[model samples]
Target: MQRRKVTLKLYPNAAQSARLEAWTRLHCELYNAALEERIDAWHKARKSISYYDQQNVLPQIKADRPELNELGSHALQQTLRRLDLAFQLFFRRVKAGQTPGFPRFKAAKRFAGFAYPDSAGWRLMQHGGSGATLRIGTGEAAMSIRARGRHRFGVEAKPNDITLTRRNGQWFVSVTLRVPESACARRRTGDQRRGVDFGINDWATFDDGRTIDNPRWLREELPRLAALQRQRARKKGSLRFKRLGRRIARLHERIGNLRRDFVHKETTRMVRQCAILATEQLAPKTMSRSARGTVDAPGRRVRQKAGLNREILSAGFGMVHPMLAYKAEEAGTRLHLSNTRQIKPSQRCSACWELVPKTLSQRMHVCPCGHTAPRDRNSALVVLIDAFNTQHTPGTGVAARPKPLPRQRGKSKSVTRETPTTAPLGA
Candidate 1:
């Protein structure tokens, strides 16, 4: 499935805003009530209630309460559907050993209405303009308009939730669109495979020894950002403080936009170049703990590392792999997830086939057997070898094998050694 998201700046008149607020409240109420009903049913029968069953009751309820018709029957039904979906997700997570709490009532600042694929509650007011019109309630008081992007297409806007959010004194609506799966299939396909290593020193390392250095804009701007924040705090709610707050927010926005741009460009380039891509499965929360420094210089190093880690996270190293997987599928390419631990791509010698243990600070690969190369390049070669072996192995397991020491011409042969050990690779 292909999904498109468009965020529009909403301009709602005072009356329209009030009506939208009421609709949001009603939607939230229906959602909570539906959730309560499902929980009661599940408690009684010990079986999950299906979304369709809950949806089927919407029309009857709408008919019984004619007053809710003005709030948009389609919207109310969509809210119920979302509530059902939320419960389904929570149940799934609980089964996976996750602590997923029950769905709770939506609060005002966090409230949003919904529209389904089959609902008529949502429509595109203007097909092409600075902004499009959206009708939330029956009356004109609920009508709102928003700006449009430069690109105008004849594609019809499917009924979906328009989430209203207030950020930086601006009202915005996140519009979700369902597009044909073929839309993102324009990428090229290739047979080459790749492995990626993510690091704080270098944002990412390819099997080919290429490294994308982290920009660390936040680290660079931290002093200015801290100063502005301090100024804002000292000034409190005064006009000067508000102005400083806006400045700080804008600085953050700038850094975020830059990071996003960099990730998009880098991921697109990598995806277009290789068909099959592999990367380490990283847990950001676990990784962040190691980023702190010693007690002596705790704050300095911790802040610096944290800033760098944040940039790496925002760069979407983890997200890029999944995106490439689906994008590769659309492009008729195969994307594989390889076991990085067993691979030991970084520690293995590519030329001499010896295990070369090195610290993170070592940027060059120097073998005692007279082989030398860039660390990242050597790691990449090791990854390629692992991939080749994985494809050739009969079973799914990554069995260990002795490293083939480099042969020397005219030298005497020595006795060989053999050892059986557990495989290093695990998915």
Candidate 2:
């Protein structure tokens, strides 16, 4: 799906800027008022208030106060939509066992300007030099930079008040445009299927024994980040402190960009090479919660787990899987999400079917049956096997058995008991 986002450099004159701010404030007021009314009605009648009821009354209210009409009917409609979204979120949270509360008024620090339906076509007045004239209402405002490169044109501009705002000295503008989709013909040549295991020490391991190391960029940058934060905290509300805060925010943004770039590259490479790709469905949030601990009295195991989670999230494993799936479809490749819940891929030996008890610290899969391999690679092999079974003989009810491992080499021979069945791989 194609999506478009346009950022405009607005240069509204003083009078126009004030008008725009006033319009935004009025929009926020109408939104909060509608929300309060709905909440009060729900409290008194024990029933959900509908958006239709609010929309039906808005036009009459605007007619009584003609000044409200200047804020644009479409802008008021957008506010109602926002209120509806808020109410939906509240009910969803309540249904999920969370505390629900009334929607609050929009504060200045977080205020967003209004949106209006396109009716009158807006004009971008091209001018000489490095700037352009943006005509809004009866006035023309000159911007410092011209819209060039692949920047979107044909945006129906609204009143200056609907443009961006300067918050804490940073400027922003919002413009909407329709994006056209470009199709590419799919070409398929690969005949192999690949299974990937995502981990902490390594970003991904394939069944073919290839591995990608975890960059751990966040961990590496933590020391510098902590130092900057400490310095900023010491300055309190000073200008230097704000600058440092901005620097820290920029650093985070940079790291996020880099991580996203890496994930896209890796996912694209895999999708292009394999005819079928299989991977486990991991819950990053749950994994993160299980890894929290104090640094001074930190549990190595928990810290390691947390590190793995950070790596997984940074690599965008969850996002990459879906992206790869869609890209593969576009490329005539098949993407399969293996039923990790039924297979003990990590513990079950891929070759001899022995049960190998392994801790997170263990990097090697060494079975007493003389089968030795890298832990992730071995796990990937089992994942591939599971994928094959799922594709070929699904519901045949042939379960994997964890056989006893043979005696350790150069050690006394002892009887090994078969391990009990545990929860499946991805689960």
Tens digit of per-residue lDDT, candidate 2, span 208-288: 989998887787888999999999989997999879988998888778868877887788788677766666656666656
Across 1-427, the per-residue lDDT of candidate 1 in tens digits comes to 4565667777777766666666666676777777777778879988777778877887788798765777666666667777777878888989998999878877754664445344255555655556577655546434645545422223643434555555554566676766565554545544557767666677778877788897876778889988988888889868998789778878988887787777767766765666555554455655555455678855556676765567666555655665555555555543444454554567778776677899967989999988888787776666555555544342221242334334423333221111111112221
Q: Which residue pairs show backbone clashes in model 2?
A: 20-161
List runs of model 2 lying over 4 Å from the truth.
1-27, 42-48, 60-72, 96-102, 111-189, 291-309, 392-427
As a TM-score, model 1 comes out at: 0.69
Global lDDT scores for all candidate models? 0.62, 0.64
- Candidate 2 overall lDDT versus native: 0.64
TM-score of each candidate? Answer: 0.69, 0.70
